[model samples]
Target: MIELNVAIKDKYYENSETAVLSQLDFKVNSGEFLAIIGPSGCGKTTLLNMISGLESCVGQHISYSSNSSGNRFKKNDLASDCSKSEYLENEQANRIGYIFQQPRLMPWLTVRENIELVLDPTQFNKIEGLLAEVGLAQKGDYFPSQLSGGMQRRVSIARAFAINPQLLLLDEPFNSLDAPTAGRLRKLLLDLCREKKTTVVFVTHDLQEAIYLADRIIFLSDSPCTIIHESIINFPKPRTESGIAELEFQAKLTRQFPLLLAGKID
Candidate 1:
């Protein structure tokens, strides 16, 4: 239930001088399901890496203030009490669940075992319920090779939620699945997010998918990425992809930002 404030001054890959990301800053409110969308190779993944502390950040300033409402933190609070590296390292360790573009599962391990890889031995009993939650109740003994792509992704989702992470980061977890399958999984994810109320920052290139799943959407430019726009999805929860409201909103958005889906602000 921690709010995330991401201010990535810059990110440069090894042996390269050009910045893959620059001056990208945003805040993810606690329990807010947020999405990031942009053009291919636009540093979307890089930004997620930085937030998850998988990549180095050029500048990070972190702090928190006490509050009575039980929301003890605010976004980008620069009290200088901790460095960017220090804060991300100390606060996020063992508390983050990251779902990558691929399932990244071990072929030899059973679905139950893959999930157990992240949990304590005592928490092993939670595996059954987690598999059931992701629509894999009967497939716990199946390995990654036996399940379909969508099913494997389900296992991945189950594994991520197994930790009951305070923050969940998804890098286009449903990207490669078919529409029918992807839609089903998106609903599954939405339900889980609601039930857990975990803070989520999902990265994707699909605008419609973002609208369907996120409470707020952050759109980025091509490279040396920065926030070009942010759309707040005011639609009620449990939304449908084909709902008139969802379609109409999309139409209006495309008309307003004609090249938005193309990753162009103009």
Candidate 2:
């Protein structure tokens, strides 16, 4: 399980500070797929960064708990940690895998090489299998430049799963794809998540995407983002658009989207 109570601030002007997110508290149960949706610039990416240890927040209190052990850390713990290796080791950070908005692949490396770079040497033998899992078995030797945008994103997904992370953090990774492409990728993601039993925190602006993928949906307010509304998605797994389209609960949630954006909900 992951628990977070965090606040974030940024310098908007020379002497002024703006609250990007405030008092956002939520918990993601083990093996649950949680989706966060909010207006643009509402610190969605910032939240992911904090969780991934990529960025720090001013008033952060987060913890990670598993069957074996648990650790609690405050914002100060991150600042005082001197080495990346030490911090990762202490926080069990190696169990985290993040997919950013862009593919972020290296131009010089082939697809297989890029994925292999992050995998443990002991797991090198699984590289071929992982590539095939993402439908890139034939393209492993191809460089990023040779693939289409969607294919590159597939490579990114394969790279992330290569580590077999316990927790996956995705930051609008499909925002740029067309609707059909995005839908296909979402199914691919769902299949992998089910197979791995990994906990996921997916950030996206598309309500339909959230409805289709998440076990629960969290709606956030604008800047100084807070959870204004949340709903449990009871749809059965291996979901499809046609299957959910006829559900009244899905319709109710769809109607609530406007109110969520208007911050009219209590």
Candidate 3:
């Protein structure tokens, strides 16, 4: 299992003294998709940055712990007591993948080259397999500018999985795609994660997306953000649009979500 323990903490913007994420406590379990949603300007992005250890933080600590699922591991556990920058540098050694809001691939590189960029030179052979897995095998020669937004995102997702990270962090990764395409990609991504048993922590503002993808939904309040609600989605598996049609579940979740966002939950 991959676990996240975030204690009550505070963080501020550089130079100025203003807390962005304050007094937060949250946890995510393995094989789980925990989606976070909140009001505008609620510091959701800042909270994600802290979890990925991309930014410096104070007053609280976020820790990551992982256990095996009987698969091949390339190296020792990447979890460590290191600074954010230092941890980012060890990407090659870690199994934590990230899909940013933007498909931040290099324009100069072809799709294949972009995916291969994250792998060590010795792992070049792994590139083709990852591309095929993401359904981008035929577009290997195309550049980012030549592909549709969905295709570009696929390449990004492929690159993130090339290293087989234990954690996958997504920041509204499907924001640019059409509904059907996004739904397809979501299924593919979920399948891939099931194959690797990767734990995911995703951030999004869409309530439907949250309902469709998350095993648990984490709700954050406005600025000086803190988790106000953590609701488990107990619908039966292989979840689909049809499953969410349960009037009881729909009414219950829909009715409570507003209260959660409003910080009115106990």
TM-score of each: 0.90, 0.86, 0.86
Question: What TM-score does structure 3 among the candidates reach?
Answer: 0.86
Using lDDT as the measure, which candidate wins? 1
lDDT of 3 by residue, 1-266 (tens): 46566665677888867777888877777678788888768887777776666765544566665555554232232234555555555444345678998999999999988877777789998887888899988899998999989989889989888878778899889987899899888888888888887888888877777777778888888777887777788775567854635445657876766466554464
Q: What local lDDT score does residue 17 receive in model 3, on the 0 to 100 scale?
A: 77
User: How would you encode candidate 1's per-residue C-alpha lDDT over 1-266 as one tens digit per residue?
Assistant: 76776666667888999988878778777788999999999998877776666765545533222232565652334323456565655654437789999999988899989999988999999899999899999999988999999999999999989999878999999989899999999999999989998889999988889988889998888888888888899989889897899889888889999888667889
> Worst ten-residue run, lDDT, model 3?
71-80
For every candidate, C-alpha RMSD to the true structure in Å: 2.9, 3.6, 3.8
Candidate with top TM-score is: 1
Clashes by residue pair, model 2: none
Error of 3 at 252 (Å): 1.5
Give the winner by lDDT: 2 or 3.
2
